[model samples]
Target chain A: MARVFMKGTEAIAEAAVRTGCRFFAGYPITPQNEIPEYFSRRLPEVGGVFVQGESEVASVSMVYGAASGGTRSMTSSSSPGISLKSEGISYCAAARIPMVYVNVSRGGPGVGSIQPAQMDYLQATKASGNGGFRMRVFAPASVQEAVDMTYKAFDVADQYRRPVLILIDGVVGTMMEPVELPPMKSDEEVAAMKEAKKAWTLTGHKLDYAHRAWIQPGNWSTKVMQSDSEEDAALYKSWQKEAEAEEFMLDDAEVVLTGYGISARIGKSAVKILRAEGIKAGLIRAKTVYPFPYEAYDHINYKKVKGILDIEMSIPALFVEDVQVAVKDRAPISTCLCSGGNIMTREAVLTAARKIMEAK
Target chain B: MELIYSRTKTIQEDKVSGFCPGCMHGTVMKLIGEVIDELGIIEKTACVLGIGCCGLQMDYMAYDNATAPHGRACAVATGLKRTNPDTLVFTYQGDGDLASIGLAETMSAANRGENITVIFINNGIYGMTGGQMAPTTLVGMKASTAPFGRNAKDHGYPMHMCEILNQLTAPAYLVRTSCNNPQNVMKTKNAIKKAFKNQLEGKGFSMVEIVTSCPTNWGLDPLKCLDYIEEKMLPEYPLGVIRDR
Candidate 1:
């Protein structure tokens, strides 16, 4: 597997196409624009369909429709555009239609800025839409991770018959890096992906009303709705076992720092600098945000640990809330946060860790 | 025993389209069923349902169908048709859903010349909700939202979908017909068959705009609603072929 240098957005698009995704529908937005642009040219070359939808609302609806037709489908956008797609994504969740989408996040509350930010942590992990539906959200720290996670997302989506989201930030979405791309799916395999899911997908098959796929129990039946909700709850609980986190330099540490996505990348570098200074610092980065990977906190050497610092690129520190819950107040937590297009800095994490250590 | 007529096997048994008693949605659904049977494409046809009164067709129609979010049937149909090129894909939408909220998707899909069929059901008001004003609501028509009547200046003008679509070069067929009477019903069915046939031939974008009535919302009996459609709706949305290429 020879590594090739590619932009994060382009690699993500190519990786998805290689993973049996043949239907691409998206609306252009900053930080994630290269994704749709690459698909526009690449998908047509592979006997696939690419639609630059009229709006984010229509783009996700197109994904829902394509997925319903049993095709491996996907969509991508930035924070603001994903906000518009929330409704259709929820429809996929309720229907248990397997599909993939990506949110290359930018600073936002309302189109706040187009620069790098992790402000969408809560939106992507918690309440995605009007319906209380949960999606498996993967946060990748580098361009290579972006490519790998995107390639793996489709399989997971189909396995669970649910939507999966690749949560990245502007830096990782646009930066170029050497990534070993996955093998492309041949035409036969693409068709087979659809054929395999035909038992439930709406592929012009004979009408099977009594056993058809639905979003919310068709024709308004309260009993069916309740049963469907219970089923979804069980599926959500099962994801706890799939949660993953990467632990770095944790043994014999006096202070630890935690982050994810691009924030985690910055925090890792900060830990190395602190260790060189003999500060005994370590890092724990969550790869799956929704399942949260609370077990990772148990690795902390509590007797030697002074306190943990939660750092990110968003103000009001949304990701920190989950960090607090995961740590369960075992250690006092301090926050180092920024927002509105400010990048999370390694210096900031190191400074915060020093403050926590000096306080002890 | 002698058989005069028989319903098509494509439609599910006793799956009466939960439409209002006088609504023409069921009759139109039956006509579509007949067309599917006539063309022998029932095994490869998919319907995309838009929200509104017409959205109910998803439940009763026997052929495979997916309900799109409100106002996005055309986009959904576009994706489905492109992904499964051999399959017959069509969208069933209402006035408010297609003309107002989904105007962008409808126009873009048609302009792109997507190989899909669209069945637009215009009944002047939003029938699913309490009689609210729609994009096709007639001038001086009183609606729950437009209590003082839809004045041209204040409420803008009623949207003529077929007329607007006719201007686009991509559509192989764009026609508006009625189902208020037996004679008009036959004409509407012919238009539907034409639209479907065009899709089978790989023609780009075909639409059959049927001007039906919402008696439940129109505050009239089913009989008078027919007359209202004939007298009021027809004049505003004159029934005829707007385009064919």
Candidate 2:
């Protein structure tokens, strides 16, 4: 496949379609509007359905419904919109419905800035909804990576019978880059995929009470709830092996910089500049934030590394908490942060690195 | 001996009704089961059940069903119906679920002319949550939340879901019926059947708003609740089709 220049959100939408996603329900939000817009135009071409729901709440609920019917379904929103969708997302998780959703994140605590920001790190990975359920959270730094992750997310979602989150910032969502699109799944393949879910999916049941399909988000019986939670705990624990991060030039480095999504992309540039200036700097960019690549931090040479600098566009620095858990006092950690949609600058990252170096 | 009537296979044979005495949900569920059986859609029918007393039917319903989040049954049905058009989809919702918390979803789905049926139970009070005031709770009707009776000054008048949905341009059918008496119960069943038939014909959005009673919540015996429906509920929500097309 030839690489073609495409915006991040558009490429993600096209990738989902090629991956056999036939149903999408979403409400419009900033920095991510191109996602639904692209799906609206492209889905019909492939016999897929696109619905702009009345609100984010309804949109996620719609995806839950569609996915329960054995369709590859998805929804997308930004920070506040994702907050509105948490309840439905939790329902999907509880019901063990396989679906995908994207969050083109922006600054937020309330209705925050519309520009690109990495303010939803904790929300996406830790507290997506009422239940303490975990989702495989993917943070893509470029359009090509976004395409690849979005394409593979459906398989992972189906395999785990859970929702997957593609977490990108406004920068990655709106930026344009050349991406190699995957081959579109044939209609037969799509139908077969749905057919594979017949055992669990709700396509209606004959008077076969023993094999009836019932999609309940909650169990009314205490015994069933307890057993389900125990099973879920084991499922979440098994994800430790799936934790992934891009460890760049960490060997013999003095300062290690870390972040995810656009902030990490900027941090990588700062690492290169610091290395050119004879400062042994490296980068650890998390690809999956959930099972937060703690093992990658363990591989760092604590004897040589002076400190770690956490780079993010969130002023309060939500991502640093995970970095702290990963590093675990092996090296002193510092942060370079901004908020309210202000993009993280490579200069700020370098300055922070230099300050960390000077402190020792 | 030839059998005149028996339980529909759509209802689980062994499961006993969980509904309170004088509550009309069991009767309505039986009517729906009969409709499903008569239409021969038992194998391809999927129901989205709302929260509140409506959700209790999940255990008794033998057909495929999804228990939607509170007030989200219509939205869920929209997704299910759109993605699997061959499958028959409907939402079973209560007054608080459809008219209050889920009003946006119900109205939006209806407005979009989604080819799905909605079975709205307007029982005037919230049954599952211990008789709280519902959007359809009649003015001057006492509730747990509105102890002084739903005064017009404080609490608004009862909402007529059929009339409200009839104002929309897309709904194919909107009817209000009740299950207070044998005659009215038969009428409610006919209306439900019509609503389901409309969905099968691809006629967009049909809703049968059944004006029912919650005897436990209404502080009345089952017999008196029937009288209340005839004397009070009917005057506010008249039985008959509000829209056919």
Candidate 3:
């Protein structure tokens, strides 16, 4: 119940097990190596599997195999390693296997420096691999959120039958902060949860209540027949509807500031500063990137919300694109980009939002 | 009738023979199938197919099979075995996939003593995208890509992957055999079965390199391909146990 001081990456690893994750396969990379190290020591204690793979390619595939086997599987890496994992992520998407991928963002074009960077935002939510599948990307601003998000990632991945990523930076991954662990489920609860997940998993064996739903390309007859039971199909459909973002403050605010992860923390500070100056600016934190939380924009009092400021730590303005897509036809949005780990400051975000408000 | 004895074929969907006629992929596939069946590991096994002709093996295998780009099968199999340690796992890879692009993965998995089997098919030339020079292509052997035969001076000698892998103390077994003739096929089948069964016995990394053929790439008929493997590749690659520790 009490919070303990933990590195952001370690907190995530601890929280994952607490949330019933039983399998972890990862390749060691800087900034987030602690995540795997923690698991290597902790996983076996709980009868979970922990593997330090030979490469990122295998790490993700290992996750894919374990996840398909009805294990709560996860893998984490930095930029270059994440790039190598793209292939398996695509396969996981194609197979609709549920898993989690932690990308502790690092500076990179090709094994570039390993400080920190938000350059992988687009790669995480968009080009994770081939296919139109959306990976749920969580941008946690603090070690607390980092731990909390890791626990949520499993449920979200299972809910969507796709990969969910906790996109942290080198700073967040290495930073030490107080984090309260999620309540650990009892063995019975853990077993029940795993059993529930088996309903859709391709585990080696099955019970009488569970039937197989095979997927094959170019099988017209099979496609027409659709073996998915009505109940399972409906469960899949409900997940699509629950996809949304967390809109914070912004009821009567004139200019809504949009942010996520580390940038959101800065935006919160900026909002306080803006309010101190009598500027009616609030914040909307994007909790989930894919699914983009378009509903957050709909809930905004559009008449008072004249503009949106997107503060992100990225080079190509990746997350801002999603913000624009989310706010389309609802409100105009502007952006402040911080490339290669150059974190966005509170003043810069406030200034950008003020500029948008003034122009509007 | 059964070669290696697997329970089911996970790659049965694709009908096209990506391998040359009489190439060892089909034989090796059946052998792997036999092993899977005999061991009763098919339901829980995960197979990784390396790029080149053997890569498409996943298309016909009926288990939970996956394909890795060239030379990456060992790397992929390492992941599969590590995460799903309870399940039996192996990689199906050709020479180019194992010795060239994926050399690091193969060597590293073996060195780490990862509990998995590697079914290495050494057909001497790149077979999937047409014949090309390969790490295991014999000296004085002509390939379409090699044109004037592989030269030790220019391309280095054909790597003895089995011999090289045997040097790693971590590996439990390393056997090299041929799939060119019936006798060799039987030996190859036995080698594959033993390699996989080693893991089932809790033995560490085991590899079986089957000296195979690529009739299409070797510019020979199916029978000639077998002849070439038996006469040329076997002598150079050698056919025997290099390690059993």
Global lDDT of each candidate: 0.89, 0.93, 0.76
Candidate 2, superposed: residue stretches over 4 Å from native: none
Note the residue pairs that clash in candidate 1: none
In candidate 3, what are the lDDT values of residues A1-360, reduced to their tens digit? 997999999899999999988889888888788989999999999888887777887677668766765678889999999999988787776656788989998877788778878888788776787654566677787899888888888988887677787888887888899888999967687677767865444433321212332312112245443553343355544555556555666787888888777777788888888888888888888766654676777767888887888877776777787777777768777788777656677778877878877783
Per-residue lDDT tens digits for candidate 2, residues A1-360, read: 998999999999999999999999999999899999999999999998999999999999999999999999999999999999999999999999999999999988899989999888889999899979999999999999999999999999999999999999999999999899999999999999999998778798788888889998998899999899999999999998999899999988889999999889999988889988999999999999988898999878999999999998998999999899989888999999999999988889999999988884
Best-to-worst TM-score order: 2, 1, 3
Q: What's the TM-score of every candidate structure?
A: 0.98, 0.99, 0.86
Please rank every candidate by lDDT, starting with the best: 2, 1, 3
Q: Which residue ranges in model 3 land beyond 4 Å of their true spot? A: A187-240, A329-332, A355-360, B1-20, B33-46, B55-64, B68-70, B83-86
Shift of residue A126 alpha carbon in model 3, Å: 1.6
- Residues B138-187 of candidate 1 have per-residue lDDT tens digits of 99999999999999998899999988987788888899999988998999
Q: Top TM-score: which candidate number?
A: 2
Candidate 2, after superposition: displacement of residue A71 in Å?
Answer: 0.4
For the predicted complex of model 3, DockQ is 0.24
TM-score of chain A of each: 0.97, 0.99, 0.85
Choose 2 or 3, whichever is better by lDDT.
Answer: 2
- TM-score-wise, the better of 1 and 2 is 2
Model 2 reproduced share of reference interface contacts: 0.86
lDDT tens per residue, model 1, A18-80: 998899999988989999999999999888899999999999988988888889999999999
